[model samples]
Target chain A: MLENIISELEKQFQLEAVDHNSSDLVFLTIDRDHAVMAIDLLKWKFGYKHFVLLTAVDFLEEGKFQLTYILNNPDTKTDIGVRVRIDREDANMVSAHHLWPTVATYQRELKEMFGIDFPGSPRLNDPFILEGWEGTPPYRRDFDTKAFAASFYHQREGRTTNDPATYMKEKLYPNE
Target chain B: MSKKEFFPMDGDRTKYPEIKSDGTADIDLSSHKYIKLWHGPNHPGITGNMAVELTLCGDEVVEGITHVGYLHRGFEKLMERRKYIQNFPLVCRIAVPEPDYNEYNYATCIENLTGIDVPEKGMWLRTLTLEMARLQGFLMWIGGMAGAIGFGTVGQWANYCRDLVLDRFEELTGGRIYHIYILPGGVRNDIPEGFKDRMEKNLREIEGFMKDIRRAFFDNYVFKKRSVGVGYIDPAWVFDYGIVGPNARAAGFKHDIRKNYPYAKYAELDFEITTAKDSDIYTRAFLRFEELLKDIDLIRQILDKMPEKGDHISKVSNMMNLKIPAGETYVRSECTRGEYGYYLVADGSEYPRRVNVRGPSYTHGVALLEKMLVNVNIADVAQLMVSLHTYPPEIER
Candidate 1:
């Protein structure tokens, strides 16, 4: 059933990769430019109408961010995850809010958290979780959370870590 | 079937900031015709710490900007650093009213990524707890829904009824609010002795209270007047906005995750999906009430079908350092409010590469609420919000 979608899609655009995770779920990779068009095809032509989610994963070592758009078909009960890779340094992509209005919210979060830019998405500049966050997008791998916390807050004195086995042996069964 | 033919909405799009082709109205603050009002972060009408900035023209709201992040704990970023097993305790904090959905989805995602087998008894126990969570979640929502419209008596009765279900949870999982019971490979423990009988007793008492609530809340003229046609969720918005659970069900959509994408013991259990065609505040509230009763029957079915004695947990070799392969999968369950999902990405490391917590409220509360709030009377904002059954933590998380 999913093979038909892959074949049909391959005719119009170049297929980067196709993964059949399960009977009802399939993940397909395509170039960033054709990503939105492929998703549009899946929605109108294939009936994958329900917009599940749009999330980005930062691969700092490779200097790339993989954006995954998961769309579900309520009628056929199948899911298609379209994966697109974009450069992390100057991250930008086509806005899909035209397809799903709620995609603007996802795009907003992506813009605020990963420094990704969706030019035409509404409220793309407004903060999602943080109102005026100025530092590097916190979700990026290069952004060290421990360093951020250590620099911003103070550690309380006399706080210590103890291995449960060693601490239990020293306190409960001292002679054992 | 257009609802306009049956019951005309309370008000059509009022004259105010003109709506654009994209279904959004720009709030022009400079105009003296409109006044801005902040509807919470502290108000009881809202489920969690969140506020709506309502742009009002007299008593009608022209535009509502949803403001979240007041309660942002940043669990997603925190999960990126924590080990696989370490995040078990933290996932349940995502949704306070019903936390088991988070635990179940997170655990199931981990199991799927690592290819771990959960015992049958464990699956049954997980189902029992999830249904119990749904029952309690709906009970709490009823309290909020009734209280939103000044029906305080029903709220009190609903809370008391909810305490009965929490008592059952206390006995089974050893905690009232956060059970942390459903683990990755299976469950934390076996069912307690006489737990079924105790739960059955509570279910009967709850059923009795539900009947009383139906009379006091649903049948009342004030509730009907305030909610009957107050907020109508267009059936077309079901797929557009990713609406799920009772919200979509109330819109006459038979799209229940447990039925469409069966998981746990739901495939073995028999139940009907609750649905209605009205798609208004009253219809959604009443649909949820009916679903609350169905949950009681499902609890009974689980108790009857469960095995007598068996393994409830599978042992993982290492507790502290469990490394998962590079894979990504999305696991979801039919939660009380809607379809709660966990999208996990593991990069062959002890720490999860990325974890996206998908709460049904992410759509219903923020974007949909903002859209629905336009042109609605200020007085009905709370009632309309409660009808949507949104939890703010899910949005900010």
Candidate 2:
């Protein structure tokens, strides 16, 4: 059933890579430009109407951010994750709020956390969670959370915490 | 499909703001027609924290902007640096009401990525905890929903019922609120002896309270009058707005994750997806009440079918030693509110490359609340938000 749908999509849109995680879940990695167009086809043409989520992962060494859009077809009980890779240097993608109202929220978070801009998205600059955030987007791979917190937030005296695993190794198995 | 069929919202037309060419409410404060009101950030009538910046003309809300971040803790960011095992207890804190779903999804995602199979008995126990989480979550939601409409006694009764379920959790998982029971491979521990009998007794007591809840809360005229036709969700908005669980079900969509996807022994469990066409506050509340009763039946079914003696958890020698292969997968389950998910990415490393929490509240609490608040009475905002069944911690996560 899924083969037929994928074949049909392959005939229309340019297919980059197709990998199956499970029997029902198929991951389709497409070019950045044609990602939303394929999503439009999946939503309007195929039965993949339910927009599950939109998220990005930083592939730091590769200098690219992989954006994944998971959509669900309720009728067939299947999911297709459309992945698109955009350059990290100039991080921006076409906005998808026209497809789903909730996509705007995801885009807003992406802008605030990952520094990924979604052009034409409403309230793209509004902070979703972090208030008055001015530094590098925290979710980016290069952003050091420990360094940021130590410099930004103050700690009281004698309030130092220790990692239990590391503490156990230091106290019990130090000679190893 | 028009909302007016459900309930014709009444308001003074002259006082109402006009819609601009861009489809936004032309809420000019200089005209002195609308006054801005903040709903919360301080106990906004829900357990979690979030405020709706409402532009009101008289009693009707012209527009509402949902302002959040009071509970933001950067959970996703924290998970990136921590090892896989260190995040076991962390995931449960994402959603306060039903943390089991978070644990289950996080565990299952790692298991899927690592190719770990849970024991049969472990699967059954996970299902039990998930259903139990749903049971207690619904109980607490009943309290909040009833309390929203000035039914304070029912709220007390619902919380009491919720406390009984928490007792069962405390015995089984050693935690009432956050049960880090569902691990990557299996559950934390086996069910204690005589747990079935005790749970049965508790179910009976809860069923008795449920009878009172139905009579005192649902059958009450004031609750119906305040909620019957209010907060109507158009069925068309289900897919477009990413609505799920009871909110989508109440709008005549027979889409439940358990029914559709059938994860974690739910395929064997016998239960019907409760739905209503009304899609308003009262219908959603009543539908959830019915589902709470259904959860009791499911718990009994799980208990009846559970094995007497077997491995409740699989062999994972050390949680800290676990690692995932290079891959990405999304795992979701039917949480109390909707489809709660965890999108995991592993780069063949000890620490997770990225773990994004797809909490149900991320959509329902923010975008859905803002969209639904238009033309609603200031008093009905809490009722509508509660009926959508959103959690602020999940939203912030």
Candidate 3:
């Protein structure tokens, strides 16, 4: 069934069906431009109707990231996985909301958290997180976790003391 | 089937858009409609923090609008901020009623991503816990459905039985509601000294309880009257809406994640996937009951075939700091609620780059419920809602 999908999709969209050892899980690769179209075709032609999830992986050294749309078809009892790679410099993809309405909200969520751009999706302007801020997206690999956590959250204000000195003064040498 | 007649819906279908796009309609908070009804942001008949405004035109409902996003704690997006270990506890909050579903899915994702293999004993333990959770979750669903259908006595009996299962869970995991017990490497502990014997006893007790359920609620005249033909869903739309678990099986879809894609020791268990041919509320409710019985049988199989003495958990070399391989994997499990999946994207860092949770309730609540609500009487709205058994927090998460 997946081979049939791969053959028909090659004519309409640029797709690469990668061979992997992950049995029972079919992973298909598509360009960022045709990701949503491929998703629509898979749903319409095949029985892959359920939108499983949308996630993105960051490759800092390679300077690119991969976004995957996992779908499941209960009728066929099969899983159809579609993936697309976007450059870290210009991370954007066509919004999938036109075909799958639920994907629209998920795309907006990805944009807010990962700083990825989905041009056609509405609600991108809505402040979902980090309202009125000026910085890189918190979800990107380049974003420093320690810096973000220390800056935004509560921590010890401006005092420094050595643990050894405190331990000695409080416990062992009481007279000193 | 005439187009002009438009198949008169039980309520004002025109108020909410036939297609749930961004904004063909908004929640109508005001206006004078004879009987104003608030169907729970906290009241009975509604699950979690959601309410439906029902303006009734005498016993018949004139209009209804749903209000949601009240318990949105943002667990999905927050998962991106924490490491894989920390996210285990966080994901449990997505569905408070059935939390092991999230934990097992999360653990499976990390296991897949890191290429770690759980031991045979660990695998059996995980399977037993999962099936036990399914039986407990089904009992809760039956209770909620019985109460919604006005079978108050049945609800009480089911709740009483479910408490026994909860007691077992608490003793097994050390926590009653959210057992943050399942981890990436393996489970938190081995079966206690006498846990297997205790579980077998509980299963026997539950078997007896299931018999009472058959007599009290399943055979009751009102339950059969209100449930059999009401809230009919086409079996063909199962793929379209992406329904899962007993709901999908009830509609004649033979998709069992455990059988089709065996993750844990489910491959070893000998059990049939419970399904129902009728596509109505009663069939849906009965499918869950049948699944409860099947889960009891599966739990027995796990206890019997499990390795006698072995490590229950895999040792974690480092908990706080460890470099994750830069890769992506979507791991799905047959959770009690439905097909719970975790889409984990690692970036060679301690924390995950993107952690999106694909829960069944999200699709079931929004897309599927909108379709099922069509032609259903507003009086049966809560009953249908309870029968569907959606956890809204999982959706908004």
TM-score of each: 0.94, 0.95, 0.80
How would you encode candidate 2's per-residue C-alpha lDDT over A1-176 as one tens digit per residue? Answer: 77888898898888789989999998988898888998998999888999999999999999999999999999999999999999999999999899998999999989998999999998889877888999799889899888998998997688778999999999999898
Q: After superposition, how far is residue B290 of candidate 3 from its true place, in Å?
A: 1.0
Summarize candidate 3's per-residue lDDT along B169-218 as a digit string, tens digits.
99889988899988877889888888888877887887888899899889
Candidate 1 wrongly placed segments (more than 4 Å): A154-176, B1-15, B19-27
Candidate 1 collision pairs: none
lDDT of 3 by residue, A3-33 (tens): 6666788888867656342655677789877
Better of 2 and 3 by TM-score: 2
Q: Which stretches of candidate 2 lie over 4 Å from their true place?
A: A159-176, B1-6, B10-15
Give each candidate's interface RMSD in Å: 0.9, 0.9, 4.1
Candidate models: Cα lDDT each: 0.90, 0.89, 0.75
For each candidate, the DockQ is 0.59, 0.62, 0.23
Per-residue lDDT value at A5 in model 2: 82
lDDT string, candidate 1, B1-397, tens digits: 4657444534566466777787767567797888989999899888778999988988888889899999888899889989988998889999999999999999998898788999999999999999999999999999999899888889999999899999988888899999999988899988988998988888888998988999899999989988887788999998888889888998999988988898999999899888998899999999999989989999999999999888999988895899998888988899888889888989998999999998999999988998888778899999999999999899988
Error of 3 at B99 (Å): 1.9
The alpha-carbon deviation from the true structure for residue A167 of candidate 2, after best TM-score superposition, in angstroms, is 31
> Scored by Cα lDDT, where does model 3 land?
0.75
